[model samples]
Target chain A: MNKTTKSNFITYGMVIAAYVIMQILVGTGSVSSLLKGLLVPLCIYVVLALSLNLTVGIMGELSLGHAGFMCVGAFSSAVFSVVTVDTITNVAVRFTLAIIIGAIVAAIFGIILGIPVLRLRGDYLAIVTLAFGEIVKNFINVVYLGIDKNGFHFSMKDSVSLNMEEGSKVIINGAQGITGTPKNATFTIGIVIILISLFVILNLINSRSGRAIMAIRDNRIAAESVGINITKYKLMAFTISASIAGVAGVLYAHNLSTLTALPKNFGYNMSIMILVFVVLGGIGNMRGSIIAAVLLTLLPELLRGLNDYRMLIYAIVLIVMMLFNWSPKAREFRDKYSLKRLFSKKNAQKEEA
Target chain B: MSFISYLINGISLGSIYALIALGYTMVYGIAKMLNFAHGDIIMIGGFTLFVVMNTLGLPPLVAVLIAIAICTALGVIIEKVAYKPLRQASPLAVLITAIGVSYLLQNVALLIFGANTKLFTSVVTVPAISLAEGQINISGETTVTIIASIIIMIGLMLFIKKSKAGQAMLAVSEDKGAAELMGINVNATITLTFAIGSALAAIAGALLCSAYPTLTPYTGAMPGIKAFVAAVFGGIGSIPGAFIGGILLGIIENLSKAYISSQMADAIVFAVLIVVLLVKPTGILGKKINEKV
Candidate 1:
């Protein structure tokens, strides 16, 4: 095997090892309760930030509706888990089926949303995505088609009806929110899912498809001239990013065991927060995105004592960072030192040895 | 009668949107960059009026004047601090900075004035004016909004066509380099453009607050986005086009909400934008520019 391949394998092994160790610590109560609380959100946010980085940073598309996609996944999974586990006798089969259903449903919605809005670029794209997010939230809020019988109106209430009963109707309460979802998201499961998402995203970024997406992002006209199919690649990035966001949403819903109204989950503020993470992490850099996601997710929790002042401080920090152009070191390294030169130097050193 | 009143109400709301759209258009014309924070400036103006009128106990009219003046200054400051430095940067950089400025201003407002909504009472105490068949009645707030918007739009048109400074702004918008070579102070002209745009926005904010009466830190976001859409719909760089576009968008959105479902109103508006773009990418009034690569 080539040295690069061997090194890549080692790196993957180390990452897997680290994830396993971290999972064990959380699972076995080896870490402090506070650290565990911090780690859970951090892991989830890392997936969110990295996935968003692929779209906004690497693909140079500003998507402000990522949270909407997440909401899609979360609700879809929650609904599936609620319906399927009751019908299926086997526990493992039910759980596996729910996850597959959730991810697939989210991916379908992602493609549906991506096709139209991916054609818009830059601020226009941002605005359209933002509108889409709001629209999704609103749509979820008002979509109440099921019956309103005495003592039990929607699927949420206790009508004592079995899953898939002839008389039973699916009803999503508008603005009142979806509640009483089953919490099946353990630390191990969340970590595994995050790892898988990271692997897929990293692999995609290294592949030819990823390069083409980046090319389109850099110069759409040129990419189009070279027959790179800008619209298709843009949609691909959108779908992939949306699907990852959906997974994060599923984890969030299962972890919380309750969700506010659709609007609550998929609001403009959530979208902005996601964008902020992408920006704070040094846009387009995977490691930077991961670090930023973790830090930002924890910062408010760390400053909980400050109460109302926490968001104020958070805003100030962001502004100061932006004003100073305080980017992560990895970004500077990538910009300053070309990959070709670094690889050539390493190759020369190997020859000398 | 109430339905007619709502219709009149919609038109007045549309007028304020048109006023705000002018600011978006003017800045985009010169910079070719959307000033995403422009709506925040309107928020600042409204908050400033609140501070001056309610906090300091000034007369409402005086407070509004003070807010307008402050917003004009803030506009100049925003241009210098956030936009001018990144003048040569990629459009994306400037756009991001604008977003940052928007967030910065919003958070600052949130810190100063908590998240709770504030009330801004109407300055005029006159009763609603009734029109034909007693079906259409204009509230004092609506009348003020319409009159103020018309006066402002006409004054702006006259200034751009007649005044020396206004002509300098026009010249700068047309070609900054040539305008600079022709002895126009480009920086001052740009600052003036911002000032005028922001001053107009402040007036719109005051008028809107009077009509609506509730204010929040993030309230400007939707209006900002809508005004931007209006600007683009009218043709981003055209002043008159912005006014027409803004009014049209406002009317369409209001009418859609009134006739159709309110939830589908935004979808319809965006659909219109998509259709318009598909037909005329340069927009209704926007001139096409040839690029040299």
Candidate 2:
């Protein structure tokens, strides 16, 4: 096998080993409840950072509405689960269907948002995506949806004059959001979803299509001259990135009993925070994104004892990490210590022998 | 509220948006960076004003000056420390750094001010004035906001038209390398642009707090984003476009809130932005850029 493929297998094995170790620790009652609660979130963030890297890092497009797609997935999946809970007695089946529905809805929205993105570039594209995110959040705040024996009912206005059975459930109550969602999500499920995301994205990156997307990112004009259909490739990466985010969202929604469309949860701030993870993890580096997402997620919680200084310390770390990663001296140091060089050196020595 | 009253209120709100949009557009024009922390600078200005007037019991005029000066310095420091190094970096890298700076400012403010809301007294407090036989009422704060915004606009226009420094700024924005070759001192001009933009943010903050009467560490964020939308709506790099865009955005936002669903107001505003962008990507007054192959 090639060196890169071998390295990829090593990384995947390491991740599986880590997951197994954590699960064993939890089973032995050695890990804290707080840490256990963080496990699923950590996985979700890894998925988000991974997906975002595909767009921001690999595809060379700046998307600021990743959280919006996550929101769409979360709400759509939550609604689906709520609607099916009565008929679909099997929890696993219901959740599987919900995940599929969420992925489809989010991918569709991704395409819709990605269409306008083709015409714009740079800051303008960023702003348009930002606008899309804001619009989604704002719309979620006012949209009321519910399912009953009377079938589906939705209205922007508060009064949803639907005649239903006495036991009808309100799926979404505007700003109050979707409540009593089935909490079937487990840490194991989260890890599996993240694995799926990594598998899809990693495989894509090594494929011929992936090379075309990267080629476009490296030089749009050059790629166009080579007859690479820019729009098709861009959409492929973007839609996939968004759908992966949707899976993460489904996992997130199921983890929570109640899901609200608060700004803190699904707003511009959330989008920016996810982007921060992708950027700080070393853009276009999947392993870096995973490492960054895991450590950064854990860092804030570990510093909870710092009380008021928690966020302050987090902010300082973000700035320092960015500077270190982007600084010229740091780049030189990284190049000198790169794993590729070490492997190549070993290969040359073997050849001489 | 009466239609005229809503119109007046929208105008006042629009003026505030215009003020903030000016800062955003100026920084974007000359520096070619979003300056994401521009919004946080507003919060700093508001807090500075609050501490000066409310705690130290300074005169309003002096308090305002101190706030403006502080924002101006903060702006320059941010440019030097965070932005200057990234000047030649990719737009994505620079944008991320800006976001980092923004987070730092916000978290620092949150650390100092705590999470609770603080009451902000109006900078302009005159007895209510009645117009059109009591059909329309204009508050003193609203009047001050409208008049001050107009004055600021006129003054800025004249400055850009007449002054050497203003001409330098214009020239630099037009073409940085060409301006540098002409001995325009691009660094100093960029620094000056940041200072001016930040000072405008301070004024906008003070006015916004007076109108809203409550301040939080996050008060500046929504307005900042809206003003950015205004900047883009008016053609990102155009000064007059920012002015008109801000005012138009304010009116649209307020009118939608009053007439349509209040909760959907933000959604409607963003939809308008999307439609406008689809129709006219360069914005109403933005110059079309041709990409060289």
Candidate 3:
């Protein structure tokens, strides 16, 4: 196998081995309820980080509104699950459909937002995405929707304003959000999605479209001069990234019984947290993102014993990680003994031959 | 009458935004990086004021001065420790570090101040004025905010136009290598910029709390975001642009809240930003530089 495939295999093997070990622990009853409860969410966060990495690390664009896309996937899927719960009695088929719906809806929103936004560069693009993200969250909050024998009802004012027929089901109740969502998201499904995200992102990075996207990121002017359609490639990468994030959102919605859009959940802070994960993971390193997301997500929980010092420690770790990652002396140290360097040496020998 | 009242309120709010935007605009101009921690500096300033006036029983003026001093020192220290090392790093890296510093400041405040809100007593001593047969009464904070912002704006303009340090700042912002070659102290200028920016933030904190009358670790976050939008709206590096953007944004926000749904005011403001950016990509007064291939 080539260098790329070999590295990809290593990453996949690591995840599977980890999963098996975790399953053993879970079966043995060695894991606590708190840690066990955290499994699905941890996987969800890992997916979110990877998806964001596709944009910030590979596409060379900083997005400050990623959670908005997550929010879109969540609320849309929640609506679908609520509406279809009775008709689709099978939980697996129902969740599969909801995930598909969530992905499609999020992709549509991404395209709509991206077409206008991708025209801008750097900070402007970042801020514009932020604005659109806020718009989506705000729009969701004010929206009210329901269904009855007559038809579906919708309004922007309030749920009462939807004016559905008597005994009709209210799918969305604005701030209160959708309740009674079936928790079809299992840890097994979470792991499967993670592996799927890993497969797709890893394979795509080695493909022609992925190369085109990276080329654009490296030098937009040069890429454009070389006949790489900047607009098409940018939108394609952005849409794909958004859809992946949406899928994670689907997992998130299902993992919980009730899904609501709160600042802590779907706001800019969440986006920033995802960005932190991407950056800390050594941007563009897919395996690194997974590890970073897992570790950072666990950091706060691990520091829980310290009480007030938990967040304080988390902040220090973020800064220290940044310093260690980018500082010149640390880079030299890492390069001397890093597995990445060892792999590069093997690739160099192959190229020379 | 209500419309007139809203307009006045908008202007008052806009002035506070203007004060905050000035700091953002200046730091962006010289440092070429967004200091996300700048907003937290305002929070730090507010807590300093609280400690001084509430705990030490100091006069409001002394408390305000102490707050400014404390924030200025904190800003310089952060720049030296967290940001200076990453001067050669990627913008994204620097941005993340700034975020870390912001998080550190916030969590630290939370530890010391606790999570409960503190009621802020107004420091502005000016009396309220009634105009047009008392139909349009203006609060002391509003009058002081508008006048103070204008004065500070003019003063800053003169300082930039005439001061030697300001000249060094302009040179460094224009070209750091060239500025160093020309014997201008680039690092010192950056430190000065952060110091000035933090001082302005302290003043802004005082005024913001006086108007809103609440103190919490998260107080500066939302307003910081709005001021950032304002800085972008007016053209990030231009002082006059920040002032105009702040006022216009305030007016738009207030009018929308009054006439439109108050809950959706944030969305409307962001929509306006997107529209402006689409029309003028560099912002209202931002200069467009051609990309050198």
Candidate 4:
């Protein structure tokens, strides 16, 4: 097999093996509920990191509004499930529909925001995306939505302004967020979504459009001179990345009984955390992003004993990880002992044997 | 009269934003990476001032000076430890490191100070200015912040235009390799930029807390972000641009809060940023650099 194919297989193998081992641990009751509960969030962060890598690593854009897209997806999907809870009696089917709704809505937001922002140059996209995220969060805070026998009611003032009938129900409670969100998200389903996301992201990275996208990232002017459509590829990568993040959002929303767009959950902190994962994992390396996400997400929980020091250690880890991934000496050492070297060495030994 | 009051308040807030944006613009100009930890420096400055003034019973001038010195030292140390090694790395890597430093400072502050909001005593003891038969009242902070920011802006412009070190900064930013060849110490220039920026943060923090009168661990985060938006609005590297952007942003935000919904004012400010960028991508005062093939 060719080098790229073999490496891709190894990436898949790593994920599947990890999943199997986790299942065995669960089967034997060796894993605590706290650790087990972190499983789905682990998948969510993994997906977020990978999708962000597509923008920051492959497309060569620093997007700081990823949490905004996630918020959009989470809210939209939760609303969908809430509206269709009685009509769509089947849990799996309803969840499938919700995921689709989330992905589409986030993709639309991505496209709308990306068009004008992407046309600009020199850090405009980054700052603009950050502003967009804040705007989304701010807008979500004042929004109040309710449903009555007649139809839907929306208001920006308060619940009293919704003017719902006697039998009406409020789907969204403004700053209180949506309650009664059915928690159907499970470890197995999250893993399936992660695998699907990996397949899509990895395949796209190795495809023709991916090459065009990377070319733009390498040298936008040169890529444009070579007849490549710069805006088209950028928009495509951004939209796909947003949709994948949206799927993660769907899982996130369903994992909780109530989904609120709190600053802690859907703020710049979350976006920066995902960026840290992407950077620490070695940008553009899909498998590395996953590994970094998994490790960093679990690090704080494992350090819960040192409650106050948890964030401090996490901060130190961020700095150390960046150095390990990007420092010159570290890069030299990593290059010298990269997986390709091991793979080639084994092939040479087999030939000799 | 109320409209006049809000305008005066807006200008006061804008001056503080201008001070913070100067830090962001200077750092971005020389180093070409957004120092995300800059906001935290503002927080540190406020806390230092708080501790010195309240806890130790130090006077205002001494507290301000101490805050500036401490912040300048901290900025230089952060650059040396967290950023210097990655000077040759990609911008993204440098940015992530800046973020790490920001979190480290925040977490450390939280550990030491706890989460309660500190009621900051205003260092500005100047009496309020009452206009239009007391229909409009402007505080001493308004007078001081506006005047101080203007003086600092003029001083910074002169320094950049005339000083040897400032010229060295311009040379390094224009072309680092050429600057090095011409015997300029690029590293020292960057360190100086960080020093100036952090010093500005301390001053801004003093003025900021005096105006707002409250301090928290995360106090700097939002205003830091807003000033960043201001910097970008003015053109990231242009000093005058940062000033104009800060003023305009403060005015718009204040007016929107008064006339429009208070909760949506943040959204309106951001929306204005988007519209402005769409019209002028390089920003109001940003010079367009041609790409060399």
C-alpha DockQ of every model: 0.32, 0.56, 0.62, 0.65
Which residue segments of model 4 deviate by more than 4 Å? A324-353
Residue B132 in candidate 1, Cα distance off native in Å: 3.7
Clashing pairs in 1: none
Compare the candidates by DockQ and give the number of the best one. 4
TM-score of chain A of each: 0.78, 0.90, 0.91, 0.91
Model 1's i-RMS, to one decimal, reads 4.4
DockQ of 3: 0.62
Worst 10 residues of 3 chain B by lDDT: B89-98
Model 3: which docking level applies?
Answer: medium
Which portions of model 3 miss their true places by more than 4 Å?
Answer: A328-353
How does candidate 3 score on lDDT? 0.89
What is the C-alpha lDDT profile of model 3 across B1-293, one tens digit per residue? 98999999999999999999999999999998888888888899898998899999999999999999999999999998888877887777777788789889999999889989999888899999999999999999999999999999999999988999988988988889999999998999999999999999999999999999999998988788788889999999889999999999999999999998887899999998888887887788998878878
User: For residues A197-256, could you state the per-residue lDDT of candidate 3 as single tens digits?
Assistant: 888888788899899999999988999999999999899889988988899999999999
Clashing pairs in model 2, backbone N/Cα/C closer than 3 A: none
The TM-scores of all predictions, comma-separated, are 0.86, 0.95, 0.95, 0.94
lDDT of 3 at B65: 96
What TM-score does the A-chain of candidate 1 achieve?
A: 0.78
| Model 2: residues with Cα > 4 Å off, grouped in runs | A159-165, A325-353
Q: For candidate 1, give fnat to 2 decimals.
A: 0.18
